[model samples]
Target: MRRPYFDLIATGAKTIEVRVGYAKICKVAVGDSLRFTSSDGSLFTRITAVKEYKSFDEMLDAEDNTGIGEAGMTRDQLLAACRDIYPPEKEALGVFALHLAPLPE
Candidate 1:
């Protein structure tokens, strides 16, 4: 199974700042770097800065394997991909549909 992870939208996002709990992940830190290609096919780097921490927000394991690395799958790309995969059904419950449905809502 693909590891479940969060994709911070690059749209209107000045910089890809991943909050690993309270501490923000940075590129220069001694951390693991992950390469990602946006939906526009732009090459970008993602770094997992914080390794160990205790916080209220769910923490992502640096070693946890997860990614949908299709070319041109930037934040927007992923959203589109997901929408295509799980399109809205005609007779779906409005409430449940809202929750299970993909982003871009």
Candidate 2:
């Protein structure tokens, strides 16, 4: 996680976590625990739902932008941001939308 994002998650502003379908990410499932950390600190969240898509375009279309990314971000901007982090080759693998609920500490 990075700034603004990590901060959003901490404040419960972001409720969905998106990721590329890498080998490790593919193993995640509903009910699993995720620890999101940044140099500042960390927050624990539990998976409430898991959605899979063939690409970022599809994922962005199917998931809510506010929950998955910065508030007020347009889908196009979010899509571009996702691509900036993940190239087309990586996007070819797949995309996953992990619905999250902050866990009790």
Candidate 3:
């Protein structure tokens, strides 16, 4: 999660947690529960759905800015930011989109 996106997740404005790393993608499954902490506070979330993509660009195309909007960023900025974090080679490795919902406290 990124700054405002982290905030969005905390506030329930964002409900998807996107990951391009194998470590996270491999471990998570639908019905899984996760806890996260950020400057806003702590959050508990449940995985409701999981989607896999062959590439980040493909994922972006399918998503059509839904996640970016939740992050309060334009498509270009989000893409650029992702590129900065994940180079082209890594992006091509693929991504996982996890649909989330707040879990009961």
**Predicted model with the maximum lDDT:** 2
* TM of each candidate vs. truth: 0.22, 0.95, 0.79
Please provide, for model 2 over 1-105, each residue's C-alpha lDDT reduced to its tens digit, 9 standing for 90 to 100. Answer: 788788888899999887888998999989999999999888899999999999998998788888977878899989998898899999898998899999977
Clashes of 1: 6
Residue pairs of candidate 3 with colliding backbone atoms: none
Over the stretch 72-95, how does candidate 3's per-residue lDDT look in tens digits?
577777667667778877766678
Over all chains combined, what TM-score does candidate 2 have?
0.95
Candidates ranked by lDDT: 2, 3, 1
- Looking at model 3, report the run of 10 residues with the lowest lDDT sum: 64-73
CA deviation > 4 Å runs, candidate 1: 1-31, 46-48, 52-105
lDDT of 3 at 57: 69
* Comparison by lDDT, 1 against 3, better one: 3
Task: Give the per-residue Cα lDDT of candidate 3 at 39.
Answer: 60
Tens digit per residue, CA lDDT, model 1, 1-105:
122222332332222322222222222343334343444433244343333323211122222212332433455554444444434441121101000112222
- Report the CA-based lDDT of candidate 2 relative to the real structure: 0.88
RMSD of candidate 2 to true structure, Å:
0.9
Model 3 whole-model lDDT (C-alpha atoms)? 0.74
Displacement of the residue 103 alpha carbon in candidate 1, Å: 27
